[model samples]
Target: MERLYQGIVRFRESDYQSHKDLFKELGQSQSPHTLFIGCSDSRVVPNLITQTLPGELFVIRNVANIVPPYRDTNDYVATLSAIEYAVKALNVENIVVCGHSNCGGCNALFAPEETLNAVPHVKKWLEISHGVKEKILREYPDADAQKREWMTEQMNVVQQMKNLLSYPYIKERYQEGKLSILGWYYIIETGEVFSYNKESMEFELVTDTFTP
Candidate 1:
């Protein structure tokens, strides 16, 4: 808590002062360009990785970076509401679903009943990506633990990207070429990012000349 307090003090004195004008302008309203859906992992810093500043990316972080398929229901949906607001109200042009290597949430999907029983809500939320687990198992039946981890993480990103388009607004905008969806796989320890190429059906390493 003390460390966080000191960091806040530094932010107010230094970072905030440096960006005072931008902050003041953003205080009035935010028009972010992208909606970044990513994991709640401490290591995956979306702004830091993307080199984006405040108000540039509207972010949604949750376990496994899941996006539930579009459904008309009376239930309260936090992530779904946020996505709607970003696309319809903020008019974000792009939506990026990022999944990272060695994701605990991805692993949790394969955990035993006792393991997941400890976090019932998380287990329930992860059901959104249950198809990811099934696909991985069906497609890579011979894969070992390490192979399964990366495959699950990468495939989960693709699954969420598909789920995003289930939203009517997103699908319409996408078909009209007014919007873009990107799936990314980030390697935490090595700091290498890979972008999914839908046509190639592969996760290509993001390099100097790479374009999303």
Candidate 2:
């Protein structure tokens, strides 16, 4: 907390000072061009990874970066609200859902055969990984540990991307060509980011997408 406080002080004194006009303008309103949905894991930071400045990316972080499938029930209201506000209200053109390598949340999907001693909320939250696990079991029934981990991490991105589209507002905007959704895998150790192409359904090196 102390470190965070010092960082805040520095931001207010120097970082904010350097961008005084931009901060002042953003103080009144924010019109971010992208809605970055990512895991709450400390390692994955959309702005830092992309070198985006403040007021540029509207961020939503959650355990495992799970966007639950759209539901008519009360459960999806919060996630739906953000999507609606980003697409309908804020009019953000891009929506990026980022996953990462060595995700603890994704690992726990097949781990801990028993949950009696685990945190209840965390267990519930990680339930989203069941789909990924099932896919692994069915597709690679005899896969070894490394294969399972890699596939789960990969498939989890696709499942979550599909879940993002389940919202009516998101679907409508996508159909009208008002929005675009991107799935990404940020490899921490390599310091490389790979983007999953929807049409190709493959994670291609981001080098092809951006030069700088």
Candidate 3:
């Protein structure tokens, strides 16, 4: 806690001070161009990775970076509300879903329910795993594998992209060509990002020239 406090103090004295005018302008209001959704893992800092300053990226992060299928469920309503606000109100031009390697949530997906519910909510949250789990079981039932989990992580990004499309406002923007939805995989160890190409149904290396 003390370290966090000191970091804030440093921000106020240094980074904030240096960007004081930009901060002052942002204080009036914000119209960020992107909505970046990623996991709440400490290792995944959206702003740091993107090098976007305050008021530049509106972000929503949750366990496993999961975006549940759109429905009338009481759960995930808050997250959906944020997405509505970002796409409809803020009119952000981009929505990026980023997943990272070595994610605990991804790893834990392979474990049994009894061992998982030390935090019941985590178990429930990752229940987004249902379809993916069935796929793995049906495809590779005999294997114990991290590769299977990795495949799920990749698919999960695509699935969340589908979930994002479930919101009508996003769909409208997409149809009009005002917005782009991106699914990204960030390799933690290598500092490389792979982008999902809808046309190819594959993830391709994001070249160095690419901003994302």
Candidate 4:
């Protein structure tokens, strides 16, 4: 808590002061260009990673960067409401679902039921990625541990992109070419990022010549 307070003090005295005019303008209204859906992992800071300024990216972080499929029921209302507002009200042009290499949520998916019994809610929440696990097993049944985990993390991002499409308004905008959905994989150890290519159905390094 002391560290957080010191960081706040630094922000108020230095970071905020340096960007006073930007902050002041943002106070009036914000028009972010992208909706960044990323993991709740402490290592993955959306603003820091993307080098985006305040009011640049409207972000929603959750376990494994999961975006539940659009449903009429209010099971995951918080996440769903944020998505609705970002798309319908804010009209963000891009939605990026980012997943990291060593995601605890992805690992928990393969843990024994007894191990996850204590965190029932977390266990339930991770069910969103069950399909990813199934797909991996069906396709890469002989893959080793490292390969499976990496694949799961990447596939989870793709799955969430599909889930975002389940929203009618999002789908409409996407079809009209007003909005784009992107899947990104961040490698924690190497500090490298890869963007999913729908055409090739593979994740290519962001620095590569491949266009999305």
The lDDT for every candidate, in the order shown, is 0.95, 0.83, 0.86, 0.93
TM-score per model over all chains: 0.98, 0.91, 0.92, 0.96
| Candidate No. with top TM-score | 1
Clashing pairs in 2: none
lDDT of 3 by residue, 2-72 (tens): 99999999999999999999999998899999999999898999998888999989999998788876676
lDDT string for model 2 (100-200, tens) is 88887887888775752466777877776687888789989999987777678878988988887788888888888888888888988898988897778
lDDT tens digits by residue: candidate 1, 157-181: 9999999989999999999999999
| Local lDDT at 78 for model 2 | 65
Q: What TM-score should be assigned to candidate 3?
A: 0.92
* Candidate that beats the other on TM-score, 2 or 4, i.e. the better one: 4
Ranking by TM-score: 1, 4, 3, 2
Candidate 3: what lDDT?
0.86
Instruction: Give the per-residue lDDT of model 4 (tens digit) for 1-212.
Output: 99999999999999999999999999989999999999999999999889999999999999999998888984648899999999999999999999999999998889999988999989999998899989999999999999999999999999999999899999999999999999999998899999999988999998757567
For model 1, give the RMSD to the true fold.
0.8
Give the Cα-based TM-score of candidate 1 against the true structure: 0.98
- Candidate 2, residue 36: lDDT: 93
After best superposition, candidate 3 residue 106: deviation in angstroms?
1.9
Best by lDDT: 1
Model 4 lDDT on a 0 to 1 scale: 0.93
Q: If both were scored by TM-score, which would come out higher, candidate 1 or candidate 4?
A: 1
Ten residues in a row with the worst lDDT in model 1?
123-132
